[model samples]
Target: MTQTCLVTGGAGFIGCAISDALTAAFDTVVAVDNLHPQIHKTGARPAALNERVELIVADVTEPGTWDEVLAKHRPDTVIHLAAETGTGQSLTEATRHAQVNVVGTTRMLDALAARGIVPQRIVLSSSRAVYGEGEWLDAQGKGHYPGQRSAQMLEQGQWDFPGLRSQPFRCAHTKPAPTSVYGATKLAQEHILSAWCLAFGTGLNILRLQNVYGPGQSLTNPYTGIVSLFARMAKAGKSIPLYEDGHMLRDFVFIDDVAAAIVAAATSDKSGILADIGTGDSLSIAQLASVIGDIYQAPPPHVTGQFRNGDVRHAACDVSATRDTLGWTPQVDAATGARRLCEWIDQRPEQLERL
Candidate 1:
């Protein structure tokens, strides 16, 4: 008997990659996505996945629709990745994020319970934003300085210059302090998953992913698609805006690695656990621009802009749990991944022209 998998937001970037991976592994794959224009531009559809996979265009928040999908598919595994994802915008549209991320997740859990068909596993695509802003503790369980200083030590004179510290940061395993509405919604979703696991005995695996970038990413949207935006600008010789002094550090995980991690989490015996999926390395926007320039074999583009509000200065994952539980680690480093992304973008001039 072949196993069936249901992937919510299967048409989106990471979701599409997960869908492809599922089709290769499982006997059947069912993808559910509303294809929201906020992420994918209006009338813009995600690239088609395998022909064997079935696509359903429905919002997960709608209880009626989920029941229909659940009854029709009866999937053994449900990978929920559909949600309103944007830190800055989530502040303005808190209710919207809550509705989609929190309410939609509730609807899915309820539908599964109603059918009395508990899936073998439930994978959630969460975000690192749940940790929120502030000084994060280092691996040694010591409190570190905020922002870039947390990751690196300052020189002798630099220590007194301003933001520099000598001790590791204090990190606690407790309730998250969400800085944005998006983070709050994700926390709520996590709580919902925990409840389902405890109350209904459903298997759950939560993946709190860092910045994931690769090809087929929509570049036209400035709110998202930072890598795509930079690639387009580099190809067209346009100025790229660097949010903040371009020193904000981020852990960029390749899309393929993310897909692999999701698949592993679904297949693994680990349940009711949260794993951070990232390369465990940090790179700044300026450094990222240089890398992209090198990939395109072009001069580094000009960067102008201050860091926007609610932006995390530094975010790198501790993938030990992910490795120990799911047996997954990120393979693509920032430089190699950026080059791959550039190569894919370079083949399509029309995409650059549109942006």
Candidate 2:
């Protein structure tokens, strides 16, 4: 039988890429999205989405959204990409985060179990957020996992907290130590899905993705995607807003690379496997801002004393397991990806006006 696949958040940045790839593999693909106005105001289908896939405008938080859809489609594969994003916003909108991320995921799994149809495979778009603070090391070169950054510590700009001469250590696929509301909920989503899938014998692939950025990301949203924000500001002839010392590190994986990894996991008959989907690379926030400025020929970002509470000091993805298991690796280098993103913004000058 020809297989059917369903993707939630199907029109967003990563969602669009995944949907496009799935269309090439599956006979039919359907997407469900509520089209949050902050990220997507068009209300119309995204121009880049494949025409073959059907789109249902619905809220994942509402029960019937999945209940009715799942009953009708009975999709062979389900790629759950829908979730509330952002560390800062998640702190402020705690309830909404729980509703959309935690409760929403529970509803999806609940609906699937209600139907008593174990999907051939289910892939949940997990996040690097789950690993709140990156692994840490001390003066003795021993390992450590620091808790949330304190307000006083961040306020005085005492960035590093040494636990008996301990400092930030680098590691990947380490047990998640989520530091924010968003991180907590994402971790919860993973736990919920893993337990449910195991109990029901549904094949599961968890992609612990790193910071994903690319062309389709929202330019106007202030709460997520530093790359998108920088590009948008540059287009408007504004100075990039630098936070902290601009030394906080992160692993930025391109959207196309992430989409390919998700498809590789979702379609594969592989079960009970979790992989770190990243470049195993790291870059500082200041460096990223400077590069984006170079792309637009804009002014260099100014470093401010401001610091985000839940932001990590540094993080780099470990893609060894990802390559070993799925035989997948990130293909797009950061420079090329940044150029493509800047070009995308230039192509849609009107969207820049929305900034």
Best by TM-score: 2
> Where does candidate 1 stray beyond 4 Å?
42-45, 134-141, 144-175, 297-305
| lDDT of the structure predicted as candidate 2 | 0.82
Candidate 1, residues 1-355, lDDT tens digits: the string is 8899999888888877776668888998998888877566775456656667788888999987787797788888888898888888887878888999999998888888888878888898888878764454555656543432221223221212143322211123423556678878988888888888777677988888888899867666666767877887777665566764577677888999998999988877778667888887878788888777666566765545444546555666667656777788789998989888888887887766665
The 10-residue segment of model 2 with minimum total lDDT is 164-173
Q: lDDT score, residue 96, model 2?
A: 95
Error of 2 at 71 (Å): 2.9
For model 2, how does the per-residue alpha-carbon lDDT over 1-355 read when each residue is reduced to its tens digit?
A: 8899999888787878877678989998989999898888778888778888898889898998987688679888988899999899888899999999999888888888888878888898988888877667677777677777899989989777665332222234376888999989988998999898889888888888888999888887788888888888776677898788888877888999998999999877677768887778777888888888887788888989799878877767777767878879899977788889888878988877655
Which candidate number would show the highest lDDT if scored against the true structure?
A: 2
TM-score for each candidate, following the candidate numbering: 0.87, 0.95
- C-alpha RMSD for every candidate: 4.7, 2.0
TM-score of 2: 0.95
